[model samples]
Target: MHWLTLHTSVPMGQQTYETSIQQAVRDLAEPGWDFRASSVGSGRSAATLRIPQRVLDDRRGARLVGAATGLRHDLVHRFDLRVPPARGPHVLTMHDLPPMRFPDEGRLPAWCTEPLPSDVEVICPSDFAASEVTELVGARRVTVIPYGVRPSFRQPAPSSPEDQRALGVSRPFFVHAAGVTRRKNLEGLAEAWAIAAPELPDHELVLLGPPHGRREELFGHLPRVVLAGKVDLDAVGKVMAAAEAVVVPSTYEGFGLPTLEGMAVGTPVVAVDRGATPEVARGNALMTEPDGPSIAEALLAVGRHEIDRDDLVRRGLARAATFAWDTAARAHLDVYRKVTG
Candidate 1:
């Protein structure tokens, strides 16, 4: 059967929607399926990478193979004119339509996404995402299939005091590894952390992602901020395992995968009540306003042991278990089967 895989426009080497989709493809291979693929986004990190030049050129061509028909073509977050995917059965995965409202740094082309029917099935990763799709493109085309977490993220049985000390985590700490983006609202989170930092002087802040230029004033003043940039999945797991909690401070999200990942590692999560975050992290996390006091209070509550770790862990595992790459892949396979049937 012929299958068209759309690689995410996300940065290369980093795990994002594209990475999750690729994993689903790999896992789907275990089942009975042989299919070809194509995508518009460049998963490559740098065009200057050592890979052959022909491969790079082929990447763009392969994704656009069916674009002429106006479907399954190049899609962006904004309301752009795009060729729609050919008629028949097809599955389109939308992480979120962020660019249309609050755009990223890049300027979008004239054609971002093509028009499709309400009955067309579009896969989303969270309830909020599904709702948003319905709000934007209508309900018939939407389904909520969260990206699955790799099973390796279970907390390492709660490291002992000595072990925690060795990892440089002697006291309770919170991890915030959001990329430097406007939507991430790192500055707002930093403002909150700054307020709480003094009360809990010993508390640590493991800032795993890079610094955003726009929020220089807020992120600049923070002391004892551990900037762990571009960490691998394994290392991230370790980091999350050690944290008292993980904070997702984004103003919006298509799927708050990290919140679930943190919970998968048995770390309690605190997130703002916004966008798909509420859906993805619903039962497993502590939702709060984006203000400083709210963040501080949420962090403090989790730190003070007011939140039941066992319950959080149990609920998190259950919620997280709902999403499996195999499940996602199987759903895609069904679509393909119907497409080819």
Candidate 2:
């Protein structure tokens, strides 16, 4: 069977979508399948379709092969729903409906909101995202496929003290690796931290990603809160490994990867119960209401050892173990078989 993979044109970075796609595509190998891949956007070149045997043979690490050319294929799998579907069998992984939900922040053109072609099938990372695709995007066929944690996160080496010092952050810190977006609820988290910081004098709140001008102004003066800036996944895993807990205050998410990452890294997670977080966390997290008081209370509880941290870590690791890239890739292949048949 021959197929084409369509990816969104995103700059190489630590964005969840980009990273998840890379992970998913790498494991999408099947014995009988012929793959050709290209990107939809113009920003960066298309994603690597096939890896060279030499690259895979490299003991040090794997390098991405060049983008494949040509569109002639039996099926086409798209990673973005924003682009129009091609003729014939097609599958799209709609990560989230940010444009439909938060119109002001992520408004899309009207064409993108139109119902997908009958030949198209949509895949979501969570049931919540599936519902959004059905209700808002008017997709007729949708599937939910949760993402997997990288092995690096599952059995991670601890980030040394020097690494922590380099980031200008210390232990007993609560890490929030999500970016500073409106849906991420950084302001709500800041407000909660302001209320809880005084009590947990030794604990610091580490905000990942690049600092936002407006959002930073609100919480920059807060005590013991470190804006660690954007770091790679390795650094993130290290910080998470050394953290007291991973704080996910986001009110909206397609799927809460940070919560799972924290769990995989054997750290407890303190997250607000909103969007797809509850679905992803599945009672493994210290879930709180989407408000300042509740978030602050959860933070305090984790920092002070008021909750059963060991239990949370145990349950989280167990749950995270079930989500594997191989399984997800097989599921994708199943969908492909169904659609092509």
Candidate 3:
């Protein structure tokens, strides 16, 4: 079957969704399958079917593509939740329902609230997300194919002094690589930092991701908290490698990539028990409730050297090794086959 990936979304710098599609395509093509890609505008290739961004942006564009090129393509797959109408079968990857869960988050478009087409095949990165799709979108079929941590995170080079200087890493700190969104439970993290700040006086809490306007309003009082806005994944891997611990305080996640990335980098991770985190953590991370006190307790445990850090890191590495892009690619191929056949 000839599968084409429709990449219509612009790169907004939160690399998770974009990175997943890019990595998947790279691996999918690695096996020399008839994998093709279509974007807003790009040079034509044997494997690339160029589609204008404006043409795809139109409400009728998806169906028009099917009518125009249906003979050439067997299936279409979208990486994000924006599943426009198509004449033939297509797959949509609903990363999470943040727009539905936190209606005011503004991270996703309002169209996310609309129920997905019943005919469209849905793909989720985790079972937790699949449940949401089943309940909210009323999707009859949902496939859970977990994401893989990039190889850079798995065998990360140590954070050098220059890398530290670039990301404003001045001291030993706990890193939260996920952005400060409502679902991220920044309020809980702030309160938790307040509780744990006294315990680890020498350590700082590093917040990474794009800088939001409400950041200082929420975290300014905490002198120990540093807002290290938006570092690339390579820098994130290095920082995670050198951190005392990686923190994931989000109340919800689709796949919780950071949890797996932290583990891949061989760092002890502290994540909330809610959403897909526990599923991703898999007993490799110190799980805590999604509250200030619970997160604080976990933070204190890590800071005070109470838990078996070596054992935690060892287990994390072993567990993270299982989620390979090759595996994800094979699973995706299976989905494409089943969908088109």
Q: What is the C-alpha RMSD of each candidate to the true structure, in Å?
A: 5.6, 7.8, 4.0
The most accurate candidate by lDDT is 3
**RMSD over all Cα atoms, model 2:** 7.8
Worst 10 residues of 3 by lDDT: 39-48
Give per-residue lDDT, candidate 2, residue 151: 68
TM-score of each: 0.78, 0.88, 0.87
CA lDDT of every candidate: 0.63, 0.75, 0.77
lDDT of 2 by residue, 97-183 (tens): 876766445545455666766556888889988888888868888889888887678847667888877888775788888765578
lDDT by residue (1-341, candidate 1, tens digit) is: 43445343353212455555556767656444444444333344342112332333453542343343234422211111121234445566666666566767354333343344654556777777777666665546565666777666655555466755554555677887666667887766887878778777778777665444544566656865655455565567777887888898888787877787877787788899998877777667888897778888888787677888878878877877776777776675565554446
Off by over 4 Å in 3: 10-33, 40-71, 107-118
Q: For residue 23, what is the lDDT in candidate 3?
A: 69
TM-score of 3: 0.87
Sliding window of 10 residues with minimal summed lDDT for model 2: 61-70
Better of 1 and 2 by TM-score: 2
